[model samples]
Target: MNSLWSGSERVRIVERLKATLAGVVELELLRCKHLEMVDAALEDRASAAANAAELPAEEGIRAPGSTASEAEHGSTTSRRQQVSAILKVIRGHIGACVGPVFNPLLSPSLSPGYDFAAVLEWFAERVDRIILLFDAHKLDISDEFSEVIRALKNHEDKMRVVLNKADQISTQQLMRVYGALMWSLGKIINTPEVVRVYIGSFWAQPLLVPDNRKLFEAEEQDLFLDIQSLPRNAALRKLNDLIKRARLAKVQAYIISSLKKDMPSVFGKESKKKELIANLGETYHRIEKEHQISPGDFPNLAKMQELLNAQDFTKFAALKPKLLEAVEDMLANDIARLMAMVRQEEAAMPSQTVKGGAFEGVMTGPFGHGYGEGASEGIDELEWVVGRDKPTYDEIFYTLSPINGKVSGAAAKKEMLKSKLPNTVLGKIWKLADVDKDGLLDDDEFALANHLIKVKLEGHELPAALPEHLIPPSKRGSSLEA
Candidate 1:
């Protein structure tokens, strides 16, 4: 068995296990427990890798000159023991018996299809979800298991296939593999229900992992603060209070004009006054009918007349603007506070982690070090300190901006963003900012940032203004004049 498989094969297995373990952790976060079998398989592989790594190096030993073959045999035994240990852990967690496992390359006498079918049956009974990890470098399973794959497609939502060792395969081969997998899956399941196929390299640096971890943790903290600052229930209560104050202000204004004493003259004739009083009753009834308020809770016509006799319109008029202003202030303060909390949370986060060679340009500092000042001169007076200039549109779009329009109106700035961004990043930004069902983003749509901030604080109105410079170039002319 040791002679049959190379060191590269073992390494590939170890890589797959690591990838699976990471996926398991992610699934755990999402509260999905259906991948217990896959998790167990991953644990087994990880233990084997650890055991292999721990073995003493036999660098100087030769097969004939030393006991190197014996040592290698012992290592192999240890590896098997590690694998068994992992399998035991998996079995314990799975709580069910699985079918016979076979090595397709070594076990030439045994039929791969028969073994695969048996395993599938075992999984169907004992596992809630199935994940097929294939070695694209070795056998092609798509053609061999076309019928079974079709059958599995009926449960595509419950299954996924990972094309392992994608980095080893040529681009054309990878596409052909993907196409075959998709075609086979589509035959078994509806297009919408088909399971996803991921082409991943476990050894490759994750595109977002460390940075996303920091971003998500910071986002969670911001979310908590946002929730704490503006409790929805409490805001609704305040809204009701503001509405009541507005109604009272309107009522007080009518009384201050001395209109109650000459109600008949104000309304018209005596009969008209009565009609006007009746109209108030009708309005109250209409409110009750609409379930906005209860007529029984309001003052009766005669009681209302008495209250009006004592009311002062000047006081009401004076309070009206104040109440409105109070509501506006409360909303604005809460919104500003929430935004501050978010910005503070983001600011405290570590600088974004750079992943892969692709992000190197973005991660590199504005200019090379030592280009500005030499270190030994105790901050030489001759050396110029970098000016605190605001970020340019290009800098903001490329280095500082999120790939998705999470920064607001980022998609609308695509032409500007394209100057320095990759097409993949721009595509993601477009998807995020083109939220309105319309494909394009206009200046009005660009104001979504302000809208989001206002809505979060229970204020429906957008901010009084956006910065004139942030306005799109085409709209700036009209807006600046206004």
Candidate 2:
């Protein structure tokens, strides 16, 4: 839902020609600023959307299995509980919201240092997808960036290479450039599968070469569909990562205990420890052969060697089979049960209405057939009515433009003052007029307001609350009777 793009200058500032802790701090500050902008933009869009689609006085998608009367009055307990559960899960996860409230240590990158290499690693972990932008006219990879590409190679599934400004080259030239780019990547990535490359002129300006316009459009859609699938595939991806981590942890435990058991109990401890560190690769192979585990699950050899050089292997804890068995059991049995529960929940949900290539809302079932089976029966005896001329009332309501669909409490108060009624009498009318208690008056509510004002002006006392028959039909979830 959000993105932080650091330009070349910003990238250089973070690198500082050498690794520095200040670069990480600087990136955090930049992220905080970007979050502020995203929030402001969302708020503006939400407000505009609200004004554009003014719902019936009652707001919210009515929860399934609730009485229509309950939705008309307010949210039901079951609905509230469902909402609370969703928010609880979402708010607890880091990067779940577009805000600057998450702990920095909990951020995706394993590295605490934010050098150029570390930045790429952090981004590879943080984002759902990565796009490597390149100029198609001159395809080249600098030697300085080889380390960064190697880090990205670990996340090849998330990577997509884009040959931007491709229209600047002819069809034959683009073919040669793409081939060269793949050759360069094959050397750096060390992967068997070829990288997926998108070729296009990704800007507002017209394409220099129109021959590939159709091809470019299709490529653009392919990228969009890939990005769109991220939200849907997120849970599966997290579950897969959990299984990978569990496998890696089991391997690590075995490696550590093997080293500890190899240490000398009496003399020559230093020489023995040095020898183990020197032959760490052999230890990994031995552990893999004994346990029948994949070598890929082992930690980075160079990094592990550097860490092991300073460790006293004899102090390492012995591997506990019970702990490893429990993890394996959870992965094999408990996770399968969890997935079954997810499928059950998905099947029990209501189908949504798709309008104009977008999901609109839950289908309320056919109108007048009853909102559900028992809902229509509850309000069949009552209906909304105004005592005065509706058109005359609507003419006055329409003048409250842009927000003409709804009038705020203060604006309604100003108009009610012209009635010359006492504040006490006006207060009661306002309460009855705003049937939904949302503190805003739509067209029907505004007409209901004028009807009530006329009643009070004629020396009739207003009720404490609007009677069921007089409650706006929109709020009562029923249309006016002809």
Most accurate candidate by TM-score: 2
All-Cα superposition RMSD per candidate? 32.3, 29.6
Per-residue lDDT of candidate 2, residues 1-482 (tens digit): 00122487446533441232232233334334534655677689979965644553357754344466444335445544654686567442322211111123224442222243544565566566677777888766765545556766567777788888889989999899988988888898776788898888878788888888756756765655565556655555665665666666677777778888999899999999989888999999998899788777787887677667656677676666766666666566655654555455545545422133211231233432123122122234433446247788777777766284798887777888999998988888887777777789888888888877876775555666565666666777543331
Writing each residue's lDDT as its tens digit, candidate 1 over 1-482 gives 22334799747644554543343333233222323434566689979965665445455434342366466557656756665676567662312222112333124443332334434544443433355666556635444455455434323444656665565666667678778767755665565655655565434544322423332333333332332333223333343444433333333333322233434434345564454454655545654565344332443466455343323322222223433344344334533443444455545545443243433342234332222122111123332211112233334334434444333443445443534544554454344333443565543333332222223234222223333333344544665575
lDDT of 2 at 205: 89
Clashing pairs in 2: none
Candidate 1 TM-score versus the reference = 0.26
Candidate 1 wrongly placed segments (more than 4 Å): 1-87, 92-108, 111-116, 136-139, 142-154, 169-173, 188-192, 204-482
Off by over 4 Å in 2: 1-115, 336-482
Candidate of highest lDDT:
2
Clashes of 2: 0
